[model samples]
Target: MKEERRRHKRLDLDVKIELEKLDEGGVTTVKYIKADVSDLSRSGMGFKSNYKLDVGTFYDTQIQIWTKEVIDAVIEIVRCEEKENNIYQYGACFVGMTETDTLKIDIYQLFNEE
Candidate 1:
């Protein structure tokens, strides 16, 4: 079995998310790609993107963690594996999150233990 390398536990969710790719210079792109937030944690989140995002690349994202609540963040692409049906499962790590945002995610994870 593959070892779980994640530092934080994740909550299975379907939150709405928008991701904007960053250029090599770490500049945010104008185009924002929409994808479902399949899973979440204080450290990072998971989703699938139609566009192939390179691992180690940076992206700016807006995630609707709760109804009527959205948080903006920067993330580094950690994994991008091509799954069946031509979809890519993308995993990223939060890069520039505040203490408040980290607490919010911890609270959410606590409230949503599977």
Candidate 2:
């Protein structure tokens, strides 16, 4: 079997995130620290986390402050890696991304480039 490799588009950002798992019941949630967003794309993002996320695990992600301005989307863990410092790296893909969300990301990157 061949290992599935990732082709990534990277942007370095020091953004900290409160990664959360919103329950289906809408009454409970689990919070985790997402150290930074390493690489981001319209489809997904790569972040460093203290906990390991099993490959194929799904979640509802909220981008901390951007919550009110954007719609929440479901994401799936495509890869999880353990680093030397005990940090787990996660590569997740958006499961149901909207075009508006993609535009928002593009706009953010545009401003970032300026």
Candidate 3:
């Protein structure tokens, strides 16, 4: 029998976070935690949140890296699934991430070198 292998980029040091949807004109929103990032890709991320966000809902959020550097980006809810503990896992696609923000994330990953 052959064993099946799964491929995924491991994530480390998940910190507590808060995310909020931006307003129409100006960027404003309600801050709420439970936004723990689990998986991250070039164009999206998987996170846990108690708040229910509709698919396609766009949010402008600031991710605080372990280095204390903040990376700001816009994200859109792509999918959501309810977990066993009443916690919700959300998959968000990067809607509009600035080059600087993307670069910051890449650099952080390099230094961490999981």
Candidate 4:
């Protein structure tokens, strides 16, 4: 079995999130896509999307948690795998998430564990 290497625990999630590709300078491009979130953590997230995202690319998006609060974050694609029927699964790390937002996720996770 592959050893777990993640720094934070991931919360299983199922939600749709909008993503806008960011240029090298951190500016948003005209390209936009929607992805289905599979899991979330303070450091990163896993998602699947029909739109293919290049590894090492950055994207801006807002995630709405179970409490209905939205957190804006910029994520960098670290891994991508081509799934069946042209769907892509991606692993992304948060590049521009504030500490407060990260704390919120942690708090939610703590509550969920009980």
What are the RMSD figures for all models against the true structure? Answer: 1.6, 4.3, 4.3, 0.9
Instruction: Count the clashes in each prediction.
Output: 0, 0, 0, 0
Model 1's TM-score against the true structure: 0.90
Report the C-alpha lDDT of model 3 over 1-114, residue by residue, as the tens digit: 855232334345476667777767856677654588886655677898777788878887777777888777788888899987778888788878888887777777787784
TM-score of 2: 0.69
- TM-score to true structure, per model: 0.90, 0.69, 0.75, 0.96
lDDT of 4 by residue, 1-114 (tens): 989988999999888999999997766797779999999999999999999888999999999999988889999999999999999999999999999999989988998899
Q: How far is candidate 2 from the true structure (C-alpha RMSD, Å)?
A: 4.3
User: What's model 2's lDDT at 111?
Assistant: 66
How would you encode candidate 1's per-residue C-alpha lDDT over 1-114 as one tens digit per residue? 999988899888887677888887777689877777789888898998677888998888877765456667899999998988877899999998888878888877777764
Ten-residue segment with the worst summed lDDT in candidate 4? Answer: 23-32
Candidate-wise lDDT, in order? 0.82, 0.68, 0.74, 0.92
Mark the regions of model 1 whose C-alpha exceeds 4 Å error after superposition: none
Q: By TM-score, is 3 or 4 better?
A: 4
**Pairs that clash in candidate 2:** none
Question: lDDT score of model 4?
Answer: 0.92
lDDT of 2 by residue, 1-114 (tens): 976465534445555665566455653366654656676666788888877777876677665323336546677788888998889888888886678887777766676677
Q: Report the backbone clash tally of model 1.
A: 0
Off by over 4 Å in 2: 1-8, 22-35, 64-71
**CA error at residue 37 for candidate 1, angstroms:** 1.3
Q: Which candidate leads the pack in lDDT?
A: 4
Error of 2 at 77 (Å): 0.6
